[model samples]
Target: MDQRQDILAQWAADQIEQLYQHSIPAQMVTVSGDASFRRYFRIIYSENGVHKHWIAVDAPPEHENSRQFVDIANVWSNAGVKVPSVLAFDEAQGFMLLEDFGDVLLHPELTADAADGLYKSSIDSLIELQQIARTDNIPAYDRKLLDCEMALFSDWLCEKHLGLMLSCDEKLMLNQVFETLANSALAQPQVMVHRDYHSRNLMVCKANPPLHDKDFIGIIDFQDAVYGPLTYDLVSLLKDCYIQWPREQVLAWLAYFKAKSAQITDINEDQLVRDFDLMGMQRHLKAAGIFARLSIRDGKHGYLNDVPRTCEYIMQTARIYPEFAAFTEWLESVFLPALNKEKMA
Candidate 1:
């Protein structure tokens, strides 16, 4: 084990001892990690003759904000959302002891037959999350952030990863498209947005007949929650980067989300569709760029496999809006062919 993992393991043991009066923990086993710098592990030990399991987090103080994660978990948990409870944490060392939600992520369980039920539960959880009153800690998904995130596409995916230098005209057109997307986001009603509210971050507990069970949700990787456009999370769920759903099915779910979120956000289907479309464009660009950054800068190349799917979302949305016509033409005629060549070579 590395020095940091050893430190985290010792820290977790001491914390467990304090929590249950000398309850020693077993060796921590590595759990799956995400695109970020954080690592997770599962620890099991006996307490009062019953086995107890907890997930230990190594967030690395320089790379992650453990304090914000604990704070948001508390905030959302109190709001009746089912988040992994933060049992304890050390902000300085960036270590945390979290409730174990087992190994069931919502992604693999999302079958064609079970999609509707599982999504219904997830959508309910999302609406409840959005209803949480904004706190000072919650950041606004503002114009600056929106534009900065979208620029990742041109900067990381296009220039850094794809080696595509944009012409002056191409650069200007991309900027305009970015501005249009950001404005569309800013125009929508702001709500509590779990920035990465896709299937992978969600855990499926007791996935059975009771789809509406509030306790069935096991939400993780929610440290980046923001006050943003209502449609952002919805689009992330339906047009997931790692998975694809039929357009007709996606629209159907969008309608359900619109109906479910009506009390919190008021908008007609046409406007919601437009906002959802444009908001998706913004997110997919950000996601594609993030995936590229993950591959090139972070040495995590598996995420590159998902870039095409993310770009497909962008291409599909670009086709829907006339304002994105130039962007669409550029993508079809220039960007996609470059991506295909990059992959082939």
Candidate 2:
């Protein structure tokens, strides 16, 4: 191992021994993560001639909340969601050893012809999560969280990162759009939402159940899950950041989810459409602001490439509604051209 990998391995071995009181040689394999404060390593060990692998999550205490990770994992596991099993944890050290669900992300699978089956399964998993959120134990998804997320577009993307300010009429139209969207969202049936539900966070585990463990869908990066609109996670999966599907395919999946959801809970077709669109708007805007912030604050310039597509999603959705005309025009005039220039450069 190189110096950095060696240091991480040593640290993980020490932490694992202290937490589990089991002495086993640990080899750390680096794992990929999205734009988050946390990182992961796969730790392999042998004990009594039996080999096993565990996922070690290294969330530097200063940057991430390990306690929240443990709590959310427990909640999802207990609710029948396919989250990694937490074997051991050290809140003080911000280290957690969990069941390794393998490294294959769902992105590539969604692009292949097999996507039809995978998407259907993914939708089923989403429905299961929503059911978990509907339980009374989870807190209600309140208004403050919704408004704060929407404001990120104005604060980060429009002003701080893009270096452009919204005019009086423009700002008013923006708020009007959010108000309409948020009101529609608030009216929906609240459920447990994996805020970042998408292809990247889901793993196809054929070793477990639905067929092979491959049939089992492993959920990861769910520390931000909360009670929210039923359509929030759905939109996240359908309108994924890493991949895009045809409109007909997206609509078919929406219809499939609508039919499946109705069997278990109450949801009208018109209401589902409104919630899906509004939630898509919210998520797309947040993604744009986040990509911009990632470029500016985190200095991860690669994310800047995704700004155009995300902005396009926002413009496409915004134009469909008359109330957001000004915001749509502003995005077309200001954000799209600027982002396109940056992409070309």
Candidate 3:
């Protein structure tokens, strides 16, 4: 192991000893990490003849906020959304011991036959999370953050990834499109948004008939939750970048979520859908840029594979609106060809 891993393992050993009254086993396996800098380790040990497991987190305080993660876990738990319980933590050292949710990611297990019900359970959990009512204390997804996220498209995806130097006209058009998307997002009702509420961050607890009996899916990677557009999390769930659903099915789930959200909040279901569509465009653009940044900046090239699908989401939305016509054409006639050439070369 490297120096950093050694230090983390030592900290994990100490925490495990305090929690279990024994040192951890010599074998600790690394869990697959995400776009973020955090690392997770799975520890399995026999406790009184029963094999038990726990997750140890190395968040590296300089990069991630472990305190916010723990606080959000408590908030989500209180809000009735199932999240990994924080077993132990050392904020200064950026280490945490958490309850293990096993390895059943919602992404790999979801099939057409089972998607309807699983999605329903996830929607219910999302609604529960949104209805927390008093979220004024959480950071707002304000205009500054929204615009900065959209700028990543030009900064990372276009310049850094594609190595494109846009003409002044092209730059102006992109800026206008970004502004339109930002305004549309700002128009929506704000709620608790789990920033990365996609399938990959969800854990399927039971794959049976009684799926909704308890928390159907365990929520994770929610340290970046914000008070943002009501439809943000819904779009994240229904219009997932990693997985594609038919437009009909997408609308069906959108309608279902709209109906559920209406009961709790004062929302016009019809207008809510327009917001959903626009919000999706904003998210897709941001996601594509993030994936590009992950590849170019972080040296995690696997995420580059998801960029095309994310771009398709942007194009799909852009084509429907006259205002986005110029930007849409640029993406199609200019950006996509460049992206394809890079992939082929």
Candidate 4:
């Protein structure tokens, strides 16, 4: 183990022993990490003839928001949301001891036979999540933040990664469409938006023991939660970047979510569909840009593989509205050719 790993293991051991007086310290096994700078490890220990594990997070204070994670986890956990329990944390050192949700991510479990049931079950949890009242700690997904996120596509994907210099008309079209999308988001009924709520961030807890809820799903990587448009989380799930579903199937699930969501919020069928479509375009633009940035700046090239799929989402959604016709044309003629060239070379 390196210096930081050694420190994390010792601190995690001490924290676990404090919680269970007779617990014996064991080796800290490495666990997978997410897109951000956070690294995770699991320390397996024994107490009362039973072996258990606790996940230790190494989120550098400079890069990640450890404080917001603890605050949001506590708030959601109290509200009966299936978030991992926070046992102990050292905010100064950026280490946290969290309950183990185990290794089953909702991403790989998705299949033709299993997709419907898995999605419906997750949608059930989402309805419960949006019902939780927003607090001061949660920020608003305002126009500024929305615009800034969309800018990633132009800055990273177009200019930096693809080496394309946008024409004057191209920039104007993007700016106009961005304004329209952000306005649509603001006009919707605001709710708690789990910014990165998707297959990778969701855990299928079926094989693991049910501790938090009998429902058997766990949510993680929620430090970026915000009070935003109601359709944000829904669109993120159905139009996931990691996986794609048929358009018909996606809208079917969208209707299911809207039917349930409208019971709590004042959303009708037409408005929900428009909101879901527009919200997806905005998210895909941001996501495509982020994926390009991840490859160019962060040296995480695997994410770029999802950029084409993400852009296809933007194109399909753009076709629904007449105002986006020119933007859609630019994406096809300009963006796609550049991407294909990059892939070839």
Off by over 4 Å in 2: 1-23, 46-50, 133-140, 208-214, 262-266
Residue-wise C-alpha lDDT for candidate 4, range 1-345, written one tens digit per residue: 889988988898888878976455545889987789999998887656987788999999999999999999999999988899999999999999999988889999998999999999889889889999989999999999999999999999999988999888789888999999999999888889889889999999844455643547789999999999988998899999999999999989988887776443566677778889999999999999999988888889999889889988998988888988998788788888888888888
TM-score of predicted model 1? 0.95
* Number of clashes recorded per candidate: 0, 10, 0, 0
Pairs that collide, model 2? 133-192, 205-213, 205-214, 206-212, 206-213, 206-214, 206-215, 207-213, 207-214, 208-213
Clashing pairs in 1: none
Task: Look at candidate 1 and tell me the lDDT of residue 248.
Answer: 89
Error of 3 at 228 (Å): 0.6
lDDT per residue (tens digit) for residues 239-328 in model 2: 876677776788789999988884324666766776787789988888888888898899887876776677667777788778777778
Candidates' lDDT values, in order?
0.89, 0.78, 0.85, 0.89
Give all TM-scores, in the order shown: 0.95, 0.89, 0.93, 0.96
Instruction: Give the alpha carbon lDDT tens digit for every residue of 1-345 in model 1.
Output: 799999999999899888966667447999977788899999988656876678999999999988999999998888888888898899999999998888999999999899999988889888898889999999999999999999999999999999999999999999999898898899888889999989999899753323235348778999998999988999888889989999989999888887877544557789988988899999999999999999999999999999999999999988988888899899999999999999998
The lDDT of model 4 is 0.89
After aligning candidate 3 to the native by TM-score, how far in Å is the CA of 283 from where it should be? 0.9
- What is the alpha-carbon lDDT of model 3 when measured against the actual structure? 0.85
Q: How much is 9 displaced in model 3, in angstroms?
A: 3.1
